[model samples]
Target: MKKIYSLLLLVVSCASFGQTIYTENMGTPTGTTLIPAYSTGTAPATFQNSSPIAYSGTADVRITSVSSGYTAASGGGNVLINAIAEYFQIDGINTSAYTSSGLQLSFGINTPTAVTNLLTVEVSTNGTTWTPVTYTPTGIGWTLATISSGIPSSTTLSIRFTSTTASQFRLDDIKVFNFDPSCTLALGTPTAACDAITFGLDTYTVTIPYTGGTSGAYTFTPSSGTVGGDNPATVPVGNIVVSGVTEGTGFTLHITKGSCTYDANAVAAIDCKPANALPFEDKFPYTVGSALGANQTWANANTGDSILAIAGSLSYTGVTSTGNSVSFVGTGAECQTPFTATTSADSGLYARFLINVTDYGTIADASTTYFATLTDGNPSNHKGRLFIKKSGTQYQLGLDAASTTTNFASTLFNVGDVVCVVLGYDFAGNTLKAWFNPTLATLTDATTPDLTSTPTTAITTLGGFLLRQDSATLTPTITVDELKITTTIAGLLGVSQNSAIAGLKIYPNPVSGGTLFIETAANAEKTITVYDVLGKQVLNTTTADSAVNVSSLHTGVYIVNITEEGKTASRKLVIK
Candidate 1:
């Protein structure tokens, strides 16, 4: 075993303990890290003047005696005998390849004989100056000597090894430190996108490319980015289509002086997407569907579906009674308490109710609160034979039992009539119009109605209409098929065509217990596929169809992949 001890040196009668680690005669470091290169393995020789040993790259570091020198492996140069303190200052280490925020330097020593006269160990930056450290001796075996500090701070520095023999050190585990700063932004949480994620234009525009200490390229996907570990993308911006990423293992991202940079030992990447490339608010009308349950049938099966009345009555009638009051609740798709609407966006709501005209009468009572209540309704009030309780009292918008009311022309809806009762607010004219069977009898009001004395609240007490017959004593027995309430006119009008010039759509989206509908932006050769979470393809349809057979798929979360004209779009599909 080689025993390493401190050497005392005297300079001008001042005696101090000193250590000599390494000395290297150098060139600019050109080899890569951990890829078995010699450029990153050289260090400058050091001499202790009692002020703790340190040296620059110009200092001569001889690893073997010139008389019995060592060949520089299969590369160039030779290793000569001299103090080894300068070996600590290697070059070409990009430092960006280290994971997280720190660097690690690890190497081993091998000798023809059991050698152990090991002295001091150190690391440096710039391949010139170095920092010396003490090496503790363990048992007889040569274990890996690892020092984890001095990274980023000493990135340009190299490693130093001091010993009395010409043995070679098996170098491995070289790394960089402090790659992740203490002030890293906490903005990488995964979230579902609604409007495009805009980083407030001009917030972040530079891209850092990390290509060392790792082996592959990085890829940013629609929702996330993948590093060597396949984790979600932590890019600063929310939305942009960039490229120049390779797939590999062991990757890192770091920031310095307000600029981001990345490095990997075996990977290369460049920013392909531009900043703020696409930004536009989605203009689709707000939609809603009935609360899901086992015993419910929707006239329009779209969960976010809207029913439209194009000059006709849109009525919902249940074929049979399911013994349960078919009702709609204000729950969105996630079944989460629908996000409270701050404005019109939050007001996207609707209902689902059971309507049966057979054994029992269907009843709708929005009287969940006290300010509003259901009252005697007569359809003659609006050319229809239904009376409704409005605001503080019952106000009618129809003709006096004549049903001659209309929004456009002179179409009269008579008593005992049938019409689609559409209550929609016109944003353009700012009026609320109620259509009776499209146009037979229509009523228009110019003010937002106050259904409660607490005028600030909605008309919650107006929905439950008792379908009673015969003296009004017996509750009318009938089934109600569907009920929907929306803030947009188009949402209430269930039919709207897409006119955008993009090949993206979801079909049979308002899916029920049948085949799935797949719509395309244009007719072209496309690849329609469905995948589960485990990267397994559940369904693969290669033809072009507006609607596809999905009755064979089991109910669960499915990702529908549509590839047309080299553009791809994916949507989530649910089956119930």
Candidate 2:
């Protein structure tokens, strides 16, 4: 009688924790593919297919199988790369009513004996930061795993489930609320946990839950590695960053705060592919007066009459340029270059090119005419698009994260001026970042991006980049050169691996005047050697001051090689 009474009291107390905030069955996958968005929800959310950055080549289609109820599954083949991950985001979920309240998340997962990779659950409030709270059910049959966490009292709360990896697993029925069965602490660990690589060492960051958290001092212990982070704990209930972890190692994390001990399995980093090959880079290396699209490695919709290869490629600050430029107009056809699919963990595809709008169509038109866009598997969906719409005297260079025809970022551009564009999509964040004529410091630092927008439509994967030739009444005549797309931003801009030799910049690339500056990260003395396209070394000088006298060089295309601290990088230099 005494035991039964105590059990009943505990159950009643846990049940009184809170009410259901939001719940979703996630619907059923229409055959093999999971639907991008549920059209019924009032709350905002985004779903995406993600592959680890370490993986090389095209992304696999987000596969699903149905035995009865629809569930999310994974494709199998490669032993190393394994199956890609799925990211489900619950955005702007209002939890203001549950101030200082604890929350619970429950999901149903069923895996087969063949499925090897484990399912990891990560929670977050803001989109950028994430905390791995618990591991989902690993049982062979349908097993429900309910994890609890202290959710912050904000109207813009977000919970993310990263169905990281699997081959024969089925994940279905996800729900989030204050409590369903009770307020029991099933998997209430830290609210936030993430790994950061600093100087080749991996650091683990854990944040204390806001509402029902430990008080005073806490303890952290690793299974195999040495534990060194702020010993003798400061405030015990705040954020803690555990350091001194070796890279590529998995371990169990144990945190003790008074009696409420929290323990979970963790990895310094997820196991991913080792080498990623360069996707595509074209300087328009075609014969002068030759056609562009079809036979020239660039794919176009028609006979490729809309584009013509012109002489001399445009130059940017830190990137290498070669071959010729392509002049294009709105002629009904579109030219596209498909690269290796980007499954970047964070920022998706990084695209950089030099563009000069020669004519801004009609001055009275304000309707958007898209020029460049990052396309997906679907031929109709141009995920992230760049447009030029006439606004008053000048034209506004606009960027959109989705294929939406209307809204875009506004930055003025002139007729004859050359503009270097750096655009990329963040698959994990579901946002796109764009920059106009950014400097070496600007690109490397990743601050002051001209525009950033969340995707208006649910785009699954980014596979190619296209230059659309819209109607002549909409788009302007433009010249494009030195186009490159890759997995990483550093790779896209050709940034050096060594930090000391990074941030290389050359201004006024078509150097017509007297002096041209070559800058490096350390600002040390560097050797400048100029070579003409004929492979003849014309000028060589060593200078500490980042300046080179280009007056001696002739008016033609030349290669300027700069060696800083024994590290060499060549940039295409044109002296007029």
Candidate 2's C-alpha runs over 4 A off are 1-279, 344-347, 361-363, 377-379, 444-446, 495-576
Per-residue lDDT value at 223 in model 2: 57
- Give the alpha-carbon lDDT of every model: 0.30, 0.55
- What value does the lDDT take at residue 429 in candidate 1? 33
lDDT of 2 at 29: 26
Q: For model 2, how does the per-residue alpha-carbon lDDT over 415-517 read when each residue is reduced to its tens digit?
A: 8778988888777777778888888444653466787778766555787778887655666778999877767777765543222257888988888787898
What is the Cα-based lDDT of residue 355 in candidate 2? Answer: 93
- Give stretches of model 1 more than 4 Å off: 1-327, 330-419, 436-521, 524-576
Candidate that would win on lDDT: 2
Give candidate 2's error at residue 405 in angstroms.
Answer: 4.6
In order, how many clashes per candidate?
Answer: 102, 2
Cα displacement (angstroms), candidate 2, residue 277, comes to 5.4
Candidate 2 has a TM-score of 0.39
